[model samples]
Target: MKIKCSKILQYGALEIVAIYFSLLMVMSLLTGNLVYRRSQSLLAAAIIVVLTSHLYSDRRKYFITWGALGTLLASVLYIYYNLNDSSQVYLAIKYLSFSLNESCLIILTVSMLWQRTKKFILVLLLILALIIPIVFWGYYLSMDAWFASDTLLAVMQTNLGESKEYLSDYFTVSGMAAIIFIVIVAGIVWRNMQSVLLVKEKKHFTAFISLALLVSATACYKTRDNLILNTGWKAKENLQKYADFQKMQAQRKSIVRLNLQENGKQQGVFVLVIGESQSKDHMSAYGYDKKTTPWLGEAFKQDNFIKFTNAYSCHTHTIPVLTYALTAKNQYNELQLENAVSLLEVAEAAGYETAWLSNQIKYSAWDTPITVIASEANQQDWINHNIGETTVSNAYDLKLLDSLKSLKLTDKMLIVIHLMGNHGSYRERYPRDFAVFSDMSSEVGSYDNSILYNDYVVSKIYEYVRSLPEFNCMIYFADHADAVEEKLGHDASKFVWPMTHIPMYIGFSERFRQKDAAMVNILRNSQDKVFTNDLIFNIMLGLMNIKIPDIYEQENDITSTYYNSDIQRFKTLYGQRFVREDLQ
Candidate 1:
């Protein structure tokens, strides 16, 4: 009996093998984790593809249509991976596989709607047309940063005006060219490949395949951390988690009690200044060659000031760092962020009027966890308004200090000032007058200028706070550091030791210094010891002499006698690795 070639090719068995094996080979080559479990995932994915192979009866059309569109999408990923210096090879391959899986999904869905394939395809194309622009924007962003869940959160947490401003700043010539190229290519593909269609199949078969595909997709999402499975879904998951966190915080706030001991005066002010993307190494006070921190350098001479020489941020991203830093959660603690009480709550419970003055956006599409924590304060002042969700704005950090003057200071106040200091687009962070560094063209120069401006802003804030009749103590620390010299932002994907080395210092008034001599001495001695911002909650409590025994561990507080400087063992990036080992 002669084997008919048509029978063999009718079900697209050869096409399935060709496409599946090619994808598998590419993915396997990119990653070292081709172990038994991962292999099982690959096998399961292949089975789903095989089950759906019958939909593509016209093998030629299937290849042509998806091939053209896939290449276009692949080109963007290629550009992104090439531009993103920190992109690991395995992750790139994982994303590539995700792209193929996403294409498979589109194909399966379109095939199921065989009666209206053309209409479905048209609708899909239109959707892609809209989504592609955002993808293009991300590609341009990848030039200086890696895409992450945090990046998505920031994007969602911005209004249209800010989003437009962000696009204008990062949108480049290459991005425009790429968009034009994709549009022209996509138009040609759509015009020519409109005839592609799935075979007329039974409704029962279609339903079965659809269900199978759904299960396959769910399994893949559960097992793999890839772009297709993770991006939007991960962002949604984070938002839900934050919602849960808000609920938990609401419950915890009512029961939280601070152990406060009033020394002499019950009426005093304490200020916490949170800086943005500032590296301690860039400051002259930290021994940088440039005098970018003249004011801080001068402040070092004051007996009341104590600068922490060895401070690290637990995470390089703003949300994670701030989430841990502002709350009773740290790298060393097992407390879930959702359940932890924030510094604002602690301060509020202690009968101190808490104010959150920020040069950051008040709210975006989604309220970031940081925003939720910030909202817990009795009084809130957002100076930036929505000058884009990012710190790349003219709002400047100094405005926050000015806003402080407007607040009705109570007898006992806890003021938290969040600055937009030295974030990205460093030139925009400061005015021309602060551009003391001659070479404004270079990244190094612009970054130093921003630092210099930050120093001035912070010093001015210090002077104003110190001059206040009731102000007694102040603490300043950055969310995370930037590798300005290396032309790198504080992206966790490309994290370097310097990215965690943020500037941290505390100052006391002469009256306050005399009141808490032992606390001041403890902090002074612990300055040279290793500290991470995640424990800022503890130290803040220590400053107010508030002790929640279950939540606040004395060892983590720099102001405590039992304070431990052994933070080398602390982990970051969701406790995947040790901070010290990463430093090494």
Candidate 2:
């Protein structure tokens, strides 16, 4: 037991440094501060301790064991607290835990084998210990500003738009920080080499660590819910998601989703206008008391349009909802949803030239799932690329018009218009003159006015498509809805109706109606059917009048009389699903 404890103490000293550095990194993550701020001062103090190690010879005996235990304890605490996938605290917990385990294991193994190659093993151990601080310090400089997001991780890898430019900026910012980190690391090693030698063992090592861990446990328990720790985990998870998405992209090319039979000569413009953060319950067209959708109500009066009263978004957030909505995967096929070919790809395979136009943003530190879906377009335009969340943009949904007009004319075109819709800073979503709901409360009025602005944008697009000589049809649906609860924006919710109940409409030009009156009648008859947006690809396929084998379900599509709705089938706001009869 004495021999074993001596071996542990000798090698465990290295693990102590690992623990100290790991603590700095983990604490920095918990506080949502840069590693440099925590590490630089910590490293300097460590250097001072090492330079005067001869004066603290008695303290060295028991320090390593306590550090090892403290590090292990800290890692376990971080892992225990950040289990929530969405928590910002979840960000760096995964990597930090893995690194702690790896560092401890390496030190223990190298220490056990110290008899045969003591000098070489120690050198290797020393180099490895330096890695913990060196890499984290550089990471501090490069990824400090980064929030854990699929888009942020993707920005590091892709050549698309401003994401690549962000990476270029990363190189420039990390240069000076890297030099300072190396210098500090060098100073610590120069002064600490003698102390890294054999240290005397003491009996009270475990007692010291126990007290430290007890104090640490209390601190950990107190700040157990800090959201920043998940930031790193967010980046890590999104990177995995991005990888899965890329794999799906590759596999999607070989999906061979060509329709077996054609309904007719497929030549016309099929427009899919996707809106953001808009709740149907808030819109007048969907029975809201306010005139939030006056122009949309006008379109509703026309015989060429069908408004679906029972449409719900699959997910509360924009990215995930879009993943299922624009793809062939529905609730039943969600397990294989990542591999599902996108609607744009399906339209292209069905022999239509595709275009994507967006008014919200192009990229925000990452290639958004919507951006990946839009990548399938032959021509794509993003009107605004600003990365600020609180930005009061002068840009409006009407800017999508310029992008639409820029597209080269093709006989059979599938154009997707992604709108800002009722996204927050609602007042900024439209011009001040369009604030028709100003008489209402400020928050509610701004939101209602944004909806009113969306009504005009949708009307203009409908009119534009109708003016085109070719047979034209358009479908508009929000990506997801928002809850204006005390003026709060939409977030991940377990049971919220306002955040998922989005408005959907299908509009056909007179020429399109003349050519496909049967389909128009089908759409009108099925408007009241309750369905989730996950199965919306079926509706989109119906609008394009081309169906892929094994993916389309007539029973779930709003354009089919066979459309079925049960309490369990289309899960809505809460535990209670939408009933078609109740909708009426």
lDDT of each: 0.72, 0.62
lDDT of 2 by residue, 123-151 (tens): 66656445434443444455442222333
Model 1 C-alpha lDDT per residue in residues 269-344, reported as the tens digit of each score: 9999999889988889999998999888988899999999888888887887888899888888788767888888
Worst 10 residues of 1 by lDDT: 29-38
Best by TM-score: 1
What residue runs in model 2 are displaced by over 4 Å at the alpha carbon? 1-239, 257-263, 364-366, 387-394, 493-495, 572-584
Q: Report the C-alpha displacement of residue 556, candidate 1, in angstroms.
A: 0.7
Instruction: Name every residue pair that clashes in candidate 1.
Output: 157-364
* TM-score of each model, paired residue for residue: 0.83, 0.63
Q: Which ten residues in a row have the lowest lDDT in candidate 2?
A: 47-56
- Model 2 residue 505 distance off true place after TM-score fit, in angstroms: 0.9
